[model samples]
Target: MASLTVQFTLRRYVARAYWTAVVMVSVFGTMAADVLHIGLGVPFAVSTPAFLSVPAAVFMLWYPSERTLSIHSIQTRRREAFRWAAALATFALGTAAGDLTATVG
Candidate 1:
């Protein structure tokens, strides 16, 4: 969240702000998945598909509302929200899948 605040504050450093927010969200996403499985005993088998469905649901809602999923077309707040939701879901999905693979295979 702080990284996103910085992203808005520094317009000239767009790349740095973007990357920082990405890294921050990714770290948080991994932590969230870990907490669900390790801290809350969710089980990777469940979490992997659960997290995967989140992005799918997001896209299902996003495309109907926005008419396009291109990152290049993110000129509105609505589109930005969809993009961020997808990103966080994707990162969490990846984390859950990785844990599932490592534990099961």
Candidate 2:
């Protein structure tokens, strides 16, 4: 959060700040999915599609409000917020799917 604030404010950390946020989101997302499967004893078959619905839901809301899901159209604060939400949801989806493949035997 700090990096994202400093990033858009300082005008010099655009890519680095965004990348930092993405990496952090990805790591935490993986941990979250892992907790559902390993910690809570959920199965990948159940969690993968469940996580998939999140991003799909995000897109459903985002598209109706913004009329377009293209990154090129993200020129407003609302759009940016939606973009981040989608990113977070998709990363969580990726984590679940990756684990499904890796652990399947």
Candidate 3:
């Protein structure tokens, strides 16, 4: 049916948008973490946990408010916003953690 087709198309668009946001956030987050250390002269020891807590705090708030963190449950604009925020935080945390290990070894 035409309705089914429209729904499918919408879902595809949403998925695309989600993935694009994730990739862009990841790239920018990594750049930010790097800049904090390399450009601002912040030590890895201080920055690693600082970057990590962002995602932790996001999830803490999101989970309590939304009751779930599953991707399949992201059905509303608010949920989508939370998902993007969490994604950005995770990417930044990952970048900082990776850089910290590299610096240590």
Candidate 4:
């Protein structure tokens, strides 16, 4: 198990951020392909995770502390900011992955 105090550290945070971005990108790519092939809209596809992740991260960050997400100090504000930033970053990464996958095909 990991320590709570170190959960929001730069290293841990970066690792999580990188993974989330990868996930988003893969999901987006798959969802796009499905849409093109089936012509049916799917709910909670790549975008679904991206959308949920943002709020989920915020909740996690704020809930852990006191409505603030701070990366540097692990305070409420810093945690909140970190959460939001991570979520956005994941979305961007997902977009890139999806785009790359689509472009290649």
Which structure among the candidates has the greatest lDDT?
1
lDDT of candidate 4 over 5-96, digit per residue (tens)? 33444444466655665555455545554453346543334544554465466566666656444345554536545654555445544554
Error of 1 at 83 (Å): 0.9
Task: Give lDDT tens digits, candidate 3, residues 72-94.
Answer: 98887667668777877788888
Per-residue C-alpha lDDT of model 1 across residues 17-84, encoded as one tens digit per residue: 88999998899889889999989999999999999999999999999999999998887767777887
* Model 4 regions lying over 4 Å from their true place: 1-75
Error of 1 at 20 (Å): 0.6
- Clash pairs detected, candidate 1: none
For model 1, what is the error of residue 28's alpha carbon versus the real structure, in angstroms, after optimal superposition?
1.0
Report lDDT (CA) for all predictions: 0.88, 0.81, 0.77, 0.50
- Each candidate's TM vs. the true structure? 0.91, 0.84, 0.80, 0.31
Q: Name the TM-score of candidate 3.
A: 0.80
Q: Which 10 successive residues of model 2 have the least lDDT summed? A: 4-13
| Winner of 2 and 4 under TM-score | 2
Per-residue lDDT, model 3, residue 82, is 80
Candidate 2 stretches with Cα past 4 Å from truth are 4-13
TM-score of 1: 0.91
